[model samples]
Target: MIKIEGFQTILYSLVDVIDSGIHIIDTKGRTIVYNKKMAEIEGMESDEVLGKKIHEIFKFKEETESTLIRALHSGKKTENSKQTYFNNLGQEITTINNTFPIMDQNQRIIGAIEVAKDITNLERLIKDNILNKGDTKYTFDSIIGTSENFLEVIEKSKRSTRTTSSILIVGETGTGKELFAQSIHNGSSRSTHPFISQNCAALPDSLIEGILFGTKKGAFTGSIERPGLFEQAQGGTILLDEINSLNPNLQAKLLRALQERTIRRVGDTKDKKIDVRVIATINEDPIDAIANDHLRKDLYYRLSVVSLFIPPLRERKEDIPLLAQSFIEKFNALFELNIEGISEDVYALFYDYDWPGNVRELEHIIEGAMNLLEPGDTKISPNHLPALFKKKAHLEEAPASKDEDHNKRETQESTLSLDDYIANTEKQYLEKVLKEHGMNISQAAKTLNISRQSLQYRLKKYQVK
Candidate 1:
């Protein structure tokens, strides 16, 4: 049994701890409850807002624009509607709001409460791209690649511009997947229309649906009838960057849209036709993404109408000189310097080093070295290079110690019994898989094709965390 006062305190504590912003107002529109999260979201103090009316703290264009006010007056609930308004500081704030009218036993509206999820950053990205009129920064000719495999990929991408089919680009991060995507869109016949590129991993699952499929006004509290990315990119191309990170349910919806050539907005009954060309990129192998359950197999088939794989920098080492010179020229214009190029020693270090970050890393390294060049220095030598390259050079040039060599030989010669070796190998594999899945027991178990309990038992037997 709990006292009424204690129960109220418990409720208040729970509300304060909630991740979403919460604000409650009486029938007269005077704010009675303002949680910490709400204060943070609005950039206001609760004490300042406590006795004030909703309109006093927030600047809504109309009374109806305030979901709390609308719910209080109309006795209607609004859920999952997006609201854009100004706080007291005049800073524009965007939130997904759910407002409900608090009614008495007689069914009369007494007060209203609003729960808001902050989505300002995500909203800014959508707004910036939605009205974009087919302007793209990169083209097929802009792509700097001369390697046989990379050139073949570029040629294939150029040929793909003839068709309106979906394209999937598979590559490591910073390997210029979006560059290829923009190039394809520019070369295609639909180059005159809008080109919108959205990273799928940018927003939460709750907001991404409305962003991708659009929303109907009555769908939720403050939701307006807005067009989604697919609608905005109609007759053009919508590039879904890091498509593997998209929610599985959204992937199914994407597949349906791709297959039917139509998309139904969120909370809408009717499907609308769209002529958007979908281009999706994944930082990892699609097959591995599917096997790890990060991507859907059926959706993969739908998206991979034409697939382009960009080779990593290490695999195409011959392009280093061209890429390095290109970056030098770019930096020369930016810094107003006329640095000629890189030296052979620097090129040797670059080739010897495995560029884990791919082309982007090379460009950054060049920029760093150029920034360090003296007034008379025309070339990027080993000394002008960053500390990372210097360290790599030191490690490569250093002679191995006899003690270290002896230990390596001893470890190589030592062997375990057959059963022991098998168990050790199994343990190593389990640890590797666990690390791959971020030590998520259930996902690792699923990948290993074993029951959770069985995996747990093995983990216990091996004392693996």
Candidate 2:
């Protein structure tokens, strides 16, 4: 009898440490014992939960109609099944429950003991995996690109999602800064929470304050007690695009909110604490913005705790083909076109021309090309490209003027030999690439797919900086 009792005690002790929530209910539907995890899921202490009626303690509606209770009363065992219930704190929880009737040696039912494994996280993982496999309509996966630079940005952003640090994205306009901010939020632990954005440049100085840190009722002509972006983004992320556009006064307020993690409504004296991850984007040089008094220096420092710079399309020409291919595939699926690929001349044209508008311009050009191509067209030729490219090609094809006229004509005509023309084009392209790579020879060479020594030879031959 002593050995049997010790074995029963060991079994009960093991049940307490099993991670899942375990509960034992008497025949009258009263909770006789609640494990530590069961109390945690209900957001309560074991002392307050134990010996209380299961329904009254947890305040769970389903406990009253629990299959475990019914099975115990009917003198049968309840098999494993899945169910969803709200805890004491009213958070939805999913559980895979197994319940069995407590019985004597003769198998007479007395009560029931339930072991419920919380499966909320598991459910979310499955759902996220499925959603990730689909169209990716509103997420980071939709930001299409396969360039090394773009892939590096994606990898860094993925790392950022694992933390709660403030992220500052610095890039020129139309560089998809906001898209990256949203992508980071979607990949974060707060994915299920709100991801709010406010463009500082879009609001007037007179209205920006109220829009961000909302006003209270009677605070102004039309003011009412309203939650601001900070409040709405609690437990999530708030993306402040064009953060440098905010005036000094608003910048001070924003800085305080970020530092203190609290905000005060327009008419409220009390500060309300908030839990929000801030992600700010700036199109201008942050240092220049501060020096020019367009942005507050202190605010700029705070926002740039983790800064990421996105290179423009002109800077990463090697990525042009990859970005173009991605855009072509996207448009083909969207428009149901079977256009195969870009022609060799079209690819060369893209390589030759500068993309002033960055990736956004590239996407538009691809869409236009897809529209021009027919169903049976295997390749999108240079003619199918925009008028600008065709114009450039025509300029490249024009014959050289005679030597007598060359001196009288423009400088471009004076040195219009095939070698000189090629040299000039190469110089223009190389100079742009060099500037984009911050004058780093190895990086520029790698971007151009040329040897560093080869790039140096060209640089010396053309007298390029």
Candidate 3:
């Protein structure tokens, strides 16, 4: 049996390792448990906060402003509440907190625990960078595709530049939806004005509300009179990437803003008129998103004044060689190498592979292969490919069987469709990497070269435990 002291030490260690800030206070509001993450978030030592009262360490203008205090008094949970206050160092800190009352069997509150996700840096970035002047890096010429379908899409987009109607660009991940949005922005009369781009998946609904719409001072603790992305992009363009990630309430607000051509800042009653062109992008089909309850039907009608669909890489295999050479030349110039181009065998393997990640995956593979070559290397051979592609190449290059009956038998036994095979392989690879990292989403995502939200989506789709 473990001693009480040893068990307490173990519990403290476990709490310290948690990703969010944890703070537990006694009934009288004396801090009893303050974890390592909390210390980092609040910029104070645990020693300083361990026995101190909440009011002594942090300043709240009113008792109601503190979520932990509210939970303690009301004996109810306060979830996903945003709090902005000054820390011990007098620096403003912002967090989304979930606070709960710890009650005994008798239904009497003993203490309160609060879990906080620090977003001070995110708030600062939104205020400083996102609200600043916006410029684009890619124009129409930067897009590299010559397929007839793609050219038609480009021509339509060019025509779209003549008007100020909102546009919706739909495509799979890495299919350059943003590239098209930027090209449209640069081609339009708004080209000389600011062009701001924001991903809807980047922040929680509560924080994102104040970010999209302007905020008024005295609205909440530490909130300043600041203009949001909409106001910042006035007279220019604003690209809301992955618009379906936004909740219904925000979507309604966005739709209203679009219809009225006016915005009311949070905590302010006056409606301000603005002239801003809205551009929204969805990774999947808008119809699918709408059917799945991810997007609002009304907002869809308002945002899709003009819709552009970008075809994925697999559908346009004719452009594979063109994109491959473009990336090869790009890397050659960037890396200062004299590699001529991809070998015929590599091209054959590329043609056989289903590019699930589309153009971005191709560029990443080419970049990886270029990193392996030296200045004297003549061309990118199959041997220079990444391990994943090398495996696929091996499977594609399986020697033709001389015995017809044996080949027919083998084919009959292995009859899984290409889609099924790729799906199974991807699921297995995701599971392997997740297990290696002990299911830490951020670490697993970093190792997979994808975003955390993307990893989470794959996990949910595959039902990976």
TM-score of each: 0.79, 0.56, 0.72
Winning model by TM-score: 1
- Give the per-residue lDDT of model 3 (tens digit) for 224-317: 7989888989999999999999998999999999999999988898998989999999987576588799999899889988888787887677
Q: How large an RMSD does model 2 have?
A: 23.7
- For model 3, where is the 10-residue window of minimal lDDT? 392-401
- lDDT per residue (tens digit) for residues 91-155 in model 1: 98998888899999998899999999998887776677643444597898899979987898899
Off by over 4 Å in 3: 1-20, 24-31, 36-115, 127-132, 392-397, 400-465
Residue 458, candidate 2: Cα error in Å is: 22
| Pairs of residues at least 3 apart in sequence or in different chains that clash in candidate 1 | 81-223
TM-score of 3: 0.72
TM-score between candidate 1 and the true structure: 0.79
Output the better candidate (1/3) by TM-score. Answer: 1
Candidate 1, position 299, lDDT: 96
Report RMSD (Å) for each prediction in the order shown: 8.8, 23.7, 12.0
Per-residue lDDT tens digits of candidate 2, residues 1-465?
569889978877887787888888887877776887876665678777667666664434544456566667776655545566665677766666777889878877778888876656644643454212112135677676666766777788888988999998977776788778888888889888878777788756855686677677866422457677678778988888898888888899999998998999887888999999999998866655777898887887788777777766765677777777788788889998877778887877777776667788878888877778765787788768777656755535756579745655777566599966876898999999999999999999999986675576467445586
**Model 1 misplaced regions, further than 4 Å:** 1-10, 26-28, 63-65, 70-76, 103-110, 130-134, 387-399, 402-465
